[model samples]
Target: MQPDSSTGLNGKGQDLKIVSLISIGQHPASGRARRAEQDGRAVELGMTLAASSSTQNLTVLHAGDSQQAALRSYAGMGLESVRVLQLRESADAVKTLSEYLHKHAPDIILTGVRAESGESSGMMPYLLGESLGWPVVSRIADIVSIKEGVAEILQALPRGQRRALTVRLPFIASVDNAAPEPRQSAFGPANRAFMEQQQCHSEPDTARNGWSIVSARKRPKRLKIVKAKTAADRFKAATAKPQGAGGKIMKNQPAAEQAQAIFDLLLEEGVLR
Candidate 1:
């Protein structure tokens, strides 16, 4: 392993260049304050990976309103500076991000699996990867290693299982929440960090909003098994079907017979042993 002085790489072999895509999330509390979304944890994971001696550089990128507070929250997590692609709220985010990435390609682009707000299709990474013609990996727990233009990744799976995958360079990844929690934001670093904004002129995608959206008073009560403690329990809950429309109404029936019917239904639904 040799260090590349020009690239600021330490004595490890792979030339690790990383970019973390960040976004604003609704605050945990009801009112004013803002936060980096749950997916922002991916950026923190990227930062941790870059902190390793093997990595060359880690850059943070965001395409959103310039004055958003979430940007500062990210900086507080120890990013020296964040690169901004200034965009309007109505701008096509996918296009804007893809355009910026195309001009300046990195070895790896990291983002959260999905955003928490506003048409959060969670398709940005996939779309960006498609635009760049690079493979996109989702639910990534960790980067095991990067060597000789190939990256070994640990993919998170259900039931606490992890799968190993090796992919060629210049790819996008959506980090899983199963990864380690991000570091807390600090006031000092956040206040000192510099922001470099670049103007973007991508057109807004109006087609997505063409469909009518309506809110109803009550949503259907989904069938869910509460307090699942095992993989089987979770699986059962996820696959469980809800009861059909209505049940037989017992009128003028014996009390003992009605009790038996109710008990039978409970057993069939697994509500009672």
Candidate 2:
């Protein structure tokens, strides 16, 4: 899909295209979750883009991988139709995906904060945007509005607060869980999508060079894995333990006395010089 040509003041012409990233296959843990949220956010943003367009014209493309499960999940989002681009699993996945995206040149591209596999790299959107000479907005929660070739975006920060940003057209934004929940697909549409397979054309491999893979008998664990049936159960497990609880509360003591008491306690605990 090509970018629409009806240039507004912000230079985004009519008939803008929105592209979403999809995982090729099953990832170990949070990988799927991250990708799912990203896809959902993409659809949510697309819906917003669709609403704001006077022509009501938009195209949704799915940069697909071999992961049938991930593809189906994305297909079921009940948004616009998906255009799938198949890339070799062993090839430089990022480069291949970027190349397809560049060919399409969608006005606004939406991706997940991170993928669920290899390096868990959250770098695709940024790297792709840099390669395409487009701006990138990470951790987007909402698309407030689009007009005159610019998009107003809402982003969730480390705290509970959200910040608003306005980016020019042809930009990339990585969606986070802060975006709307992904819609479920009706069985009919999903089945139809499977029947109507989208064809992908291979481009010259621009994959990077100089890479090494070292096999190891064991890899160090980055985080402890725990399985829980419910959100409450997960919360319970996380907050189950308390640390360093015992402390003297010297209330109603003189200022100097309190300082001495703290010093004595520190010395007793072998925490002082």
lDDT of 1 by residue, 84-160 (tens): 89988777888888877777767789998877656656888989888888999998998877666677889999778
**In candidate 2, which residue pairs get closer than 3 Å at backbone N, Cα or C atoms, i.e. clash?**
6-13, 7-13, 24-67, 25-67, 31-116
- For 235-265, candidate 2 gives per-residue lDDT tens digits of 8878875444676788898999999988898
TM-score of model 1 vs. true structure: 0.72
RMSD of each: 13.1, 12.4
lDDT of each: 0.77, 0.65
RMSD, candidate 2, Å = 12.4
Runs in model 1 deviating more than 4 A are 1-11, 28-33, 53-56, 211-273
lDDT of 1 at 5: 22
